[model samples]
Target: MRGEEMNFEPMMKMMSLSSIGLMIWIAAQTFTPPKEVVVYVEVPAPVVVTQVIHAPISTARPAPRPDSLCLALNIYHEARGEPLKGQVAVGQVTLNRAAVAYKGASSVCDTVFARKQFSWTHEDPRQPSGAELRPSLDLARKILAGRYIDRTHGALHYYNPHKVDAWWADSYAEVAVLGNHRFMR
Candidate 1:
């Protein structure tokens, strides 16, 4: 018992790809925004990343495959406290941005993770994958499936009026006010 030493390095170094920190680093190094993105699933030993799939962005008015996990993450982080219609509005803005290559990003992931666009992206993304994530995912699918109404009124930009007076806000035309955000076109 006197010479017992617990090895903690293994616990400390689990998986690098599991964290959004690495993803942020990779995103920064990547200059060009892609039309699609590939996400990896971490498996047990000998199989670091098991599956690689293309993240659906946009195809038609109602996308053939409208559900993108990337889009869901944005809604979850940006409008977690917002109501159902509010969440859909936020999702619409993200889609609006991607449709027009806002901030030089074409894909949902790129637009969401764009430098300084969304505050949450710059911070730590713990990568929560559970029931708590369902609301956003469901909303993402619904909005993209052409089911939910466009509460944003085709607005391409939005911001919380109470939070900060964004300089750019003065320029865009404010279209809708839902929950805690002001949607602009």
Candidate 2:
């Protein structure tokens, strides 16, 4: 009870209390679960989403493999047993337009010929007129090369002199071998 007296019992009790607290802490740590846990997972069914990307599509199809529009036309006409002279004349018209020192533009008119132009009227007898007068070099080249003869109705066809017929002409007489003046070797 004195101020200067040593408190042994109190000190002993405090030490005991601390030792009990330490024992409890150690026991809790010893019984603790592992640091990492394991789990099982399953994947669900695959999901497919269709996305459309914008790209240019050519409504026009591939044409024949002739080098000159005239030749292809001739081949087509000759194949059908039609007149070769007219086909060649058509080809010549194309070349003439191509060589026009006066027109100052390429004779090739297949690209810009409107639907209502002179060439669009198939039964008009003047199918080979105006811009359509020129033969398509692209058409000729296809005939010459002996490639696919598209002859499709729409944008693909040998431009008739004035007619816009979609019917395909044969390439027998018109399609001649290169430099041989003949369709086949």
Candidate 3:
């Protein structure tokens, strides 16, 4: 009976230890993070693969002439919201300035970008985008091509008449009052 009791006790202890070890393993598995696994499959012979590539096409318009571009930018920035005649008048002023040797500028671009000439050019020193400036560009092209009549009467300067106290306004002869701006000689 003693021998049997001893054997039974040892068997019980071993069973308890195994059960505790199993519980600990289960707890460890619960706390562990899952890992990503990738699987690969093999295809049988006689399989075909195909791929097609398409090239991109350009829809950009040709760049305008340098003088015309400068004129267009000036008109667009100066009087884009003004009437057609007003825009042409602004272009005429730019061309008139270019013709003269203002600040030693022999080209329209130099005249438009001359120091203290157009306030818009000074504000943002970047070229105007082509999409938003279609009307101004067209008018500038026409003016450069000499296709439109000069509405400013050969006026070389202009300013918004609504503003107060311009020093240069009194110096030059007021040529024409078209739209919000006053063309000056």
Tens digit of lDDT per residue, candidate 1, span 79-169? 8888877888889888888888999998877888789888778889777665888778777778777787777878988888787687899
lDDT of 3 at 44: 25
**Sort by TM-score, top down from the best:** 3, 1, 2
TM-score for all models, in order of appearance: 0.60, 0.23, 0.63
Best by TM-score: 3
lDDT of 3 by residue, 1-185 (tens): 11111112333334444663464345334432233211112222243532222212123345788888889889988888788788888999898888886677879999998998988877875666668777787778889989977778888889875653567788889889777789988
Give model 2's TM-score versus the native structure: 0.23
Per-candidate Cα RMSD to the true structure, in Å, reads 16.2, 31.0, 25.2
For model 3, the local distance difference test gives 0.70
lDDT of 2 by residue, 112-172 (tens): 2323422323334333332443343444564344354322211212343233343434531
Q: Which candidate leads in lDDT?
A: 1
Clashing pairs in 1: none
